[model samples]
Target: MQIFARNLTGRTLTLSCDKSTRIESIKDQIYTADNEDGNGISPPQQRIIYGGRQLCDSRTIEDYNIQQFSTLHVTGSLSGGELVYKFIVVVFSIAFGVPILKYVYRQYVSKLIESATESIANAQKRATERVSGAGRRVTNNRLSGRFK
Candidate 1:
């Protein structure tokens, strides 16, 4: 009998098998078929799912009641090496990303402080100039009245 194996990319493989065929054998056949098509997927990395259940290697095709032309979905499984690589990437991102964020925050706060200080200095200078101008006007008025 022949069953169909459908991959994540929607590619279908027509494989020849029977009820007595082991799930492991099916996986091997899938690996071969995929490699022939330049996919390079190994049997250990291939996960076969049918009827919402993952097929076990020790079970036979008949054990799962797989019918003729039944579509078995093939998905990729992450190996230990792949898992380790992903972990390293995440760790590095967090390790470097936090420091960069802190630097940017500090720079922004410094600029804000500097701008506020400059504004306060300008306000004080204006107030002092106004006070000094008033005093000079009062003194001149008093002197002119006395001379008259």
Candidate 2:
């Protein structure tokens, strides 16, 4: 099984382990890959959780029902679950924000189109009136000249 492990330091590793391999050995592999200057964390001290369940050393990855490409969270210490809350909040904000922004944009475009249409119609009306008035003036001038 392929598992993606992420540490609290934001270091991640894509590890391949046999389905029968125990969680304890997986933690050892991660520890070996990034021992990094006497961090002093043993595999037992590192807490690994997957899918909301704390993984135990005695259980195999398959026994815990962990699947391929599953994320394993390894934290040196426990926080107040702030990361989970932030992820939910951001997702909801984007879901609610997109339609509102799209509606505002559509309203703005419709107003612009309406104003342009009105301006064009008014200009056409004025040009038609001017042409008709000029033709009438020319016809009257010709008639009066012939009578004189």
Candidate 3:
């Protein structure tokens, strides 16, 4: 049976394959076809998607229920170096990012608490001074009135 293989550049190739054909064989054929067109894509870098599912190399076409003349979309995968770089970025973010974020959050919360405490202390001091001043004024008024 023949199936249609489409690449990212809208290039399609009719591949002759059987239901028992492994997905790896299809990838090899795709690589050869792409190389002929000067694309130079390797089999490992080629990702075949059918029915919205990625085809595994170890699986057969019939395993995924790929029908005859069905269109298989091919996409290039990320290089090993790119995958390693992404892994490193994720590891570093997890290792250092969490601690840095926690430190910043603690500092912010500490400053907020300190500011609130100072505001409350200042308010209490003002209230105490006002109450004492009022009491002193009343006492002076009473003393002055008694002397008169």
Off by over 4 Å in 2: 77-148
> 13-45 in candidate 1: lDDT tens per residue?
989998999999999998888787687568888
Tens-place lDDT per residue, model 2, 7-121, is 8778787888988999889989888876865663578678897888788888998898888888899876455797886676567669886545456569989999999999999
State the TM-score for model 2.
Answer: 0.48
**Which scores greater on lDDT, model 2 or model 3?**
3
lDDT of 3: 0.83
- Clashing pairs for model 2 are none
TM-score of each: 0.57, 0.48, 0.54
| lDDT of candidate 3 over 101-135, digit per residue (tens) | 45656998999999999999999777756643424
> Which whole-number lDDT from 0 to 100 does residue 74 have in model 1?
95
Order the candidates by lDDT, highest first: 1, 3, 2
